[model samples]
Target: MKQNILTGVLLAVIALLVALPWFAPYFYIFVFTEILILGLFAVSFNLIFGFTGMLSFGHAAYFGMGAYTTAMLLLHLDWPLLYTLVAAMALSGLLALVIGFFCVRLSEVYFAMLTLAFGMMVFTIAHSWRDVTNGSDGIAGFRISEFGLGLDLVMGNPAVYYHVTLAIVVIAALVLYVISRSSFGLILKAIRQNPERVAFCGLNVRSYRLASFVIAGIFAGLAGALMAPFLRVASPELMHWSLSAEPVLMSILGGTGYFMGPFVGAALFVLLETWITSYTGAWMLFLGIVLALMVMFFRKGVLGTFLDWWMNKND
Candidate 1:
């Protein structure tokens, strides 16, 4: 009975969150969209970092690929939003398959470095390919068309876009959550703890890791596809190493142990950026200081620490 009440309350809260843009100010609607997209990105990163015990520094490669794919589709083909997003996921998944095939052969720091190198290679291509990529300027002036599914959404309205983004993000998060709770996810946890043991049990540990990597890439690509339209441009910066750090930071802030931790962390991060940037241009300095404190004192992350305390108190 108590658990049912708790579940109901949680669902109610989620309902309110989904409806926030309808009541909140216009600027806040944009902020919510950003939080949703980045939260999904962070969650995808956590699948590898938290569950698989792998630290990838080049995750932005798939993200950038998604962004570029969506941008190109919108620019050249002008496909509907749904079709473009599908293309983005496909492109990112293919890239992840190739990259993961190589990276999964290695372990620890070497794997990270190898992924970083490949990511930088992609970044370089986006930066130097003047004819197709438009050099560093990226693809611009693209517009969203019909949303498909028989829903007639006004492309120019931010509110409509926000709802669409919110819906897709929620569905994606749910899919990830289901994956995390499955038998396959338990196998992943086993592999993370002891790959040798998992292999001894006749499990294909490398294949499992590759599967997680590709799924994470697909989710990240979805975030990137949404981002291109939000920003009205897709540039080399989307593929840069700095952009890759965004998800890592959010995961650390939110607590990687919990599925919704990155989403919470992304909200805080985006809100802080919005508030702080209005006061001064030294936001990065403040962010650096906060991150240092988080590393030193709250290694499990904000949600992780809070949940720990709550559980301990109840016990």
Candidate 2:
């Protein structure tokens, strides 16, 4: 009954988000776009951190790689959005495979440090490779041309772009949802709870972890692709250690245990930033307060805590 209720709630939220572009103000349309993209990023991170028990400190590497891939292609080849997105996912997945091959060998802190090291290496490449990456200036002024399907669309139009972003994010989120609910997902949850027990059950825990990492990278890459067009610039900043922390923070704030937790967390994070940054330079201080409170009182995450109380109260 709880699962059904949760699913209904999620569907309703997605429906509202889908229609948001129609009712939201012009500025808010863009804000919601950022929230959706970042929310997806957080959800991808939660797959390994919350479900598979891996804390990756360098997730922004794939996100950056995906963004760069799309930016590079659009700048040089002028390819369709569909093909560029496919390329972004493929490259990000490959990067994950190579990195995960070694990182999965470690556990806990070691795994995190390894991922962070790898992530920084990628960041360095983006930063130092000035000939290709354009140094700190990032990739900007690249035209999107069209979104395919022979439709007359304006890439520069914020409203049209918001709709496009909405469609892609919805489809991608649904796919992620499907994966999180499958038997494989169950095994991942088991792996998170007790990897040793899963290994005793004749499964290679390392293999499962690696697979999860690669899948997360693919989705993160897609989020990156979506982000590039919105930001109009893919730079070293996207690959920074700080950018990687955004997802981690969102997951903690929303409730990592639940699938929709990251989304809720993303909305809160972005909205808070938007509202607070306008008034003072101490927005981080306020954000830190909220996070500290969440850690102390809602360790299960905002959504997770609320659900537990609501379910228990009704019972």
Candidate 3:
């Protein structure tokens, strides 16, 4: 019955997304596109944080790397969007491998701090390396000519881009869902609960953690790749620690225990920010208050709280 309810909710959300472009304003198309991209980004973060019990403070490094890779390829090589996205994922995964090799050896705060240090290193490189990254100015004026696969798309249209983003995000989410449900995913969860027990079972705990980190980085990179064209620029700010905080906030706000929690959180975060920023300059103040309230009262997050209530009422 719980599974049925979850399926119903998922289907309803998908249906709403499918119909949004037709019924919603052009402005909202862009809004939802941002939500979908960030939703994917948050979900990627959950792979390490929620599933593997690793809290990273520098996940934005992978995200920013992906964005920069896409922007540079588009600007200098005129590569197709699809090609650039693949490149972004590959490069980000490599970066994660090198970083995670050292990070997975530590647990808790140490792990978080090391990741932050590496992330800042990447950020500093992007900020100082003016020749390649265009320094702080970033790579701009990049055009999206085709989506690649020999299909011509009107990449400039917001509605068209929205549909494309929707398609990619849904596919990526499905892939992640399968991964989270697989045996490897189960071991990752076990390692999260008790790494010593997992290690005692002859499983390499650090390897699993490193694998999760790399997978999360790849998906986060994909999210960044999608973001570059939508924003039309890839800046050093994307790699900053502040940007890294977004996925952590979204995951916590949506509830990391469930597969769809981060996405729900992303929707709430984006929508609330959009609504509140319209009326005040102190939007962060209001947002912080809301986040504090949610953490204090709704420990499970909005969706998690709703689910708990629903299950209890049904029982």
Candidate 4:
């Protein structure tokens, strides 16, 4: 009964999020759009980290690949937005497949190290490939054309773009949520709990891990594809290790145990940055302090700990 109530509340919150742009201040629409993209990115990261227990330090490689893929298509090929997005997902998924094939062969720290290595390799290619990637300047001057779906989509309008991002993100989140609740998800969790035991049960642990990694990359690519036009650039910075860390931080902030934690964490993260940067130049320092406290005290994460308390209190 209590679980039902909590679920209802969560659904209401999502409803509120869906309607946020209608009533929120104009600037807030942009902010929430960013939150949605980063939230999806963090959620994708959590799939392998929380469910599969494989911490990837190179997740941003997929993000950057998706961003660049979409950007390049828009710039040189004059591709439709929908097709660009599809290309982004395909490219990112392929990269994840290659990376995961090697990374999943290892375990624990070895897996992380391999991911980081591959991630750096990706970053280097983006940085040094001046001929195609436009060097440090990245891709620009690519105006967003028709969405090619015969639908009116004004990419220049922030509110309209926000709505577009919201719609796509919600759809992706729903798909990811469904997958998380499936038997495949249960097997991933089982593998996380004990890979040896799962292998003993005749499961190919590495294969499962690889599949999850590819799925994660596909969604991360979606987020990246959305982000390209929003940011108006797909720089090497998107592929940086620092970008990879954003999802990790968001996952930690929200609590890895829960599916919706990353979204909450992304909101908190963007809100905090916006609020803190307005007050002080050392926003990162303040963020670090708050994050340290979150780890020290609310070890379960902002949403995780809050939900834990709420459920306990209701009990």
Index of the highest-TM-score prediction: 3
> Quick one: how many clashes does candidate 2 have?
0
lDDT of each: 0.89, 0.91, 0.94, 0.92
Ranking by lDDT: 3, 4, 2, 1
Candidate 4 lDDT over 55-113, as tens digits, reads 99999999999999999999998887889999999999999999999999999999999
Query: What are the models' TM-scores?
Result: 0.96, 0.96, 0.98, 0.97
- Which pairs of residues collide in candidate 4? none
Clashes of each: 0, 0, 0, 0
Best-performing candidate as measured by lDDT: 3
Listed per candidate, the RMSD to the true structure in angstroms reads 1.4, 1.4, 0.9, 1.2
Candidate 1's displacement at residue 4, Å, is 4.8
In model 4, which regions exceed 4 Å deviation? none
Model 2 stretches with alpha carbons more than 4 Å out = 1-5
Deviation of model 2 at 133, angstroms: 0.8
Clashing pairs in 1: none
- Candidate 3 residues lying further than 4 Å off, grouped into runs, are none
Error of 4 at 224 (Å): 0.9
